[model samples]
Target chain A: MNGLKVIETQDLTKVYGEEVAVDRLNININEGEVFGFLGPNGAGKTTTLLMLLGLSEPTSGKARVCGFDPTREPLQVKRLVGYLPENVGFYDDMNAVQNLLYISRLNGIPDDLAGIKIKELLKVVDLEVDPRKKVGEYSRGMRQRLGIAEVLIKDPQVVFLDEPTLGLDPDGSLQMLDLIRSLSQDKKITVFFSSHLLDQVQKISHRVGIMIKGQMVAVGRIEDLAKEKFGVGQEKYTLEEVYMKYFKEGLL
Target chain B: MKGITTICRKELADHFSSTRFILLFYLILMVSLVTAFIVGSGLRDELKDVAKPTFVFLMLFTSPGKLFSLIQFIAIFGPLLGIVLGFDAVNRERSARTLSKLVSQPIYRDSVINGKFLAGLITISIMLVSIVLIISGLGLLLIGVVPGPEEISRLFIYLVISIFYIAFWLGISILFSVGFRSVATSALAAIACWIFFSFFVAMGASVMADAISPVDQARASLNPELLIKHEQTRKIISLVSPMTLYSEATTIILDPLRKTTQSILLMGPMERLSISRFQSPLPLSESVYIVFPHLISLMAITLVCFATSYTVFMRQEVRST
Candidate 1:
């Protein structure tokens, strides 16, 4: 646990009844880095994120975001982080601008800055098509973009995106990926995004952690981990191959 | 302050933008209008039968007496509106996976619950005002007489009391919404609870009272009217219901000027012979005082439910998945 790290989890565990949803997970994510959290379905990626976001209580151990204990100082931690949820729903009756404005206000952004920030964020997400159109009428990809725009409104130090590209079309997915990359690079924002898409994670992430069966099995630079651990050597091993090899060898 | 205001604005927008509000508004409008028409027609028929046509002003002044019957109708559905509007309030956020997004903000969870409660309260108040205006307008137009200041004051009191009554149901709905994960489950729970409190509880109380009371049915049936009077005892028993408390409160408000003057001559057994029992109706003011405890209880229960929801929401996990 150092000040340089934006997120640190030590032996963090979450149990639902007799099932261990997340077990003894340890992670450290540095500031201003695009950290990809790659995991299969039910691999505890979401559960871990929930704990880090202070949205769920861990059964045991410690987790901190921005040097504040998430469970104890959730509000303090929340003030420094922005989270885009998996489904990313807004009040469907509200338009993009209204939704962003509401989220900005909730995050305690000052009145004057909130308007300017909303406009900038909306434009950045390419959601400049009628701001007055109700969100219910928005396509899945548009809602996702609006959700991303909402998370960015407060201009927090860290932004967490959970499967942000899960439901998008190919064009929307590409656009979203570009937007996420640009947001991190241009704004110097620490991006901690989770996804099952290995190729996307490989393309965008500074470092990637692959989680399997409630444990962080691999964590390092994508290229270094592929070359050092998998030994697919000289030629690049796609993240999917690395994921498959690790699971096949039961290394996870 | 900003967080609270944000929640409030979002909740208000959602309330107004949803088709549910439009449907509820129309339903209430149609119900009130139909009620006004039926009652107006009945009053017209009653006037025709009178030996002498009194001044229309006197008839309008006394209109509350006839309008009191509609109290049952309004009381039955008023809380229904509150429950329906509020049942999905919290659950929808969870279902849509928005709860986590909202909670992840720096805002306190209490603000979400408070904003929602306020929005529901405001919506119900608006609906009540619209219904009252419609009823009052129809009264003035068809009866061709405006209500007196005292009558209007009573109507305002009735409106306030009705709002409080509906608030009770709103609180219950919020409680259900917090307690249940599924919107359908919350709604079903709220509606079921409403039915139990509104109707079943009263019936249950009457049945229990009938079994517990020491009245001998055979002797009481000597006079057919005595049987009818004994049945009236059931009404007193049913007053234990919360719905009855609200209905009685409305009755007091609507008939605030009712006088308690009566001459009764009753025959009963006295030393195996005759004894007389006579009683007069209590004045409306005194009746209001009597029901004050029940009104307070209803309001307290509403606050308690709301407080429970707030606490539950504060502790809730807002995981988006």
Candidate 2:
């Protein structure tokens, strides 16, 4: 539970009253790896992340993040793990500095250090704009970048991004994908993000977990999954083909 | 604890800078001051005829202004302040898609609600205290009279009561904000409640009283008993509105000579003569004793509203929108 595996889930389950949203999800994410979580809508990718982050409770299973039980040690987990929800937002009336300052203060970062970190983070994210510009005036891509800066304020060991490249133009998505890739490359931070498009996730994801109907249907390196699904001796199918096989053949 | 303070400070800044808050605040301040100025000018000569004006300073709040007294104005419109501040408290975060990001941070969920509520209460208290002080200062300048110790204490009590009264509405608006998902829906719902309690309740009370005790206006002299019953029923029914409770409680506190909320003028002369009339002002303790139920109910409803919102918000699903 505490070695190279930064996140480990043992049959993590989540049920919302009558329906099971995440059913017995088990995933092992290694340290310093870009783990892509792929699923269609209602596939419970966000719910799994919620349970992993301790924002939600698992119905009958357990999850551990950074060697701490999320449900019991939520503060420690949250302190060390950063989450960027889909379409995340900030106070529009305030500028980037004020918004990030609030978040840093919430994380117990001192004012002097937080100021320095905010400046450095703005530089690192390439959010080059006037300091007086309010977030309301920021373009969608700029807001996403500011979101990355906000997530990095606490210097978390693990960062979870739900649909990081969603709703962005081609150029914005490319920039976001690059930034997400560098999250693990430059900082050695574990980047666990969820996406539906296989083409984009296949580019930067060292390993990926594909969920279908609340179950993890395929998990591992894309090529390894292709080989495992179609057999090594037979013809090799593409990653997209391997992903579609689960839905195409009604394979559970 | 730090999380709570952080959120509270942020919300306070937001309230002070919000245009909606500033507009409503200035409206209340202007109306209250103008009412005090007009009423203060009118009461100078009227109070001179009295033998000994013990709590004349209290008249600035209790005396009838051009339209209504300061106390009545607050009773009628204070809910608007609370509602506007809190109607969109939670839903705004939701619609802006910031609630998920906020909850994901290293803070307890209760901190969000607690911080918003505490900030709102503080803002209301600050506004109420300043308005009272400003009006009192203006009244002093106009009438050339300083407040006595008893009058100051009464004003303090009045301030505390006004805070809770407005806080009760804040709790209500926060409840709607938490219960409803859309900002417009919650705002409309809170305003609807404000209308119901502020205006409709008064009308409904008389209708209910008439139904309970039918008093023919033409033959009312023969059945004074029925007329008295009708009046009692109307007052009882009106007490259901928080506005009624607030005005009644403040009237008792500000005008110590007010022994009861009931209309003694409707009583027969023989029956009225039997009742004791105190020409002098009653003690503060006696007035407080008479309105104990009003104070408790006001407080109880406030706690009930905030508690409901707390439980609901905590239990809700935090979905990423």
Candidate 3:
């Protein structure tokens, strides 16, 4: 809660009828750090992300992004953060550059800067192919790169990546991890990424939070938490191990 | 604005690049051309028969005149084109998960729906105009005759009316697209609604009216003179169809100088019958004014349907997996 907080939630909750997808939970994200949000399927990882991004309404309590209340000033929050959903999609008829350009414009970037930004972001994602080719022709990996390019176009202070490497090959996954890492180091941007891929999350995250059954079970620096929770002799606790341990504990 | 424009350009390009547009254009063109050809040939034959010596001497020969009736067929299918163009509009985006992505952008959700509706409307307008021009061109080339001032005016009014009719279907399609998530579901719903409006509504209304009305069996069966009464009653029932409004509008447009006749007759079993008739031609200006209200109503319905879609779209959550 004290380390250059970029996101803060106070008993943030989301309920659909009688089902509480996200319980009264609280978490804090710091600037210039890669935060990994790890959770099992249907464990409210996405629900939390949606609430943080102002995409979903919290049934009660409050959530803020970049110090602006997500629920009340979504546009202001959105301006400071870029969000990439798990299954990122765009107008398939538009190519990578076109898609990025459109998003840049929507974010109110100046028209003159949009073109340059689109090209730089595309290049950063290593998608330097024909900008005119329709995205429908792109392979899944290419589309993933294009999605990353879109998220980076506005150069926001914070970026949210939801399962960014879900469908990529090993090489593509590695590349995506490298890109996320570089954002924090080179651009001074905060990276809040959610993933079920434990190994990848372990490789890139500075701090990690493990969520289970709509609650955050563990939160700390990756190595410190792994050592403190699992002990020194225990084989290095993969994020998945952390998840399984907490899930079994919650079940018991 | 840039984001919406980008989306619209991409959507328009998809429409043009797809086989759907090509197939629709060809289908409409072929139907219009064939109908025009048949009507032109039929009119030529009828005119020749009317001018024949045998018919000239008889003094009762009447000319059917140009068989402009084919235009009615064209008008009837105009709305189908609109339905075809719009039925898949939003449903396709939902199925493909594109709508979610589009909404994720900072642009207002209404823009996505608005851009799509605008693109579909523009595409349909282009197709309709192209078909009309082709048919008119063929008419000129084949008959070596251009439409006179009156005929041109009538054709213009007919096109305007047809455009309004198409707008009604476009509105219905947008409503269906917003209401249904699955492409098949939207398409089926739209087509079902179209069928109901085009056929079942009129049939159902007439059947219900007949069922509720008291029948006079004694007068109906015993009196020969009552057959005409029954025929007139049936015509009145058929006028309940929307198609009847379209036909009435078409009639007024095509026959601006035609007169309407009113007649009253009295009949009794043991008495002679007396009849009175009145006829007066309606001015072109008056004919235009008469159809204006119906045209406005159809257009208003279209706008209302589109507005409903826009509202639903703005409230929709994007959660494609």
> Which candidate achieves the best lDDT against the true structure?
2
Per-residue CA lDDT of model 3 for B216-278, tens digit only, reads 678656764455454445446654444555666666666654422112244564433222232
Task: Give the poorly placed runs of model 3, Cα more than 4 Å off.
Answer: A1-4, A67-69, A72-76, A90-116, A128-134, A223-238, B1-3, B40-70, B136-157, B214-247, B257-281
Report the TM-score of chain B alone for all candidates: 0.81, 0.95, 0.77
How do the candidates rank by lDDT, highest first? Answer: 2, 1, 3
Q: Which window of ten consecutive residues has the lowest lDDT sum in model 3 chain B?
A: B54-63
Report how far residue A168 has shifted in candidate 2, in Å. Answer: 2.9
**Candidate 1 error regions (>4 Å):** A1-3, A110-113, A227-236, A249-252, B30-68, B133-153, B221-240, B257-285
DockQ of 2: 0.79
Clashing pairs in 1: none
For model 1, state the Cα shift of residue B99 in Å.
2.5
Q: Which candidate, 2 or 3, has the higher lDDT?
A: 2
Model 1 residue B194 lDDT score: 83
lDDT by residue (tens digit), candidate 1, A1-252:
123788898999999889898989888888778899987788888888878878788999999898999889888888888898788878776677777777878887777888888777777888866856888999998889888888877778899999999979989999988988887788878899999888888889989888888878888887787786556563387788877876665542
Error of 3 at A74 (Å): 4.0
| Backbone clash count, each prediction separately | 0, 0, 0
Order the numbered candidates by TM-score, best leading: 2, 1, 3
User: i-RMS, every candidate?
Assistant: 1.5, 0.8, 2.5
Q: Could you give the CAPRI-style class of model 2? A: medium
Model 3 superposed RMSD (Cα):
5.8
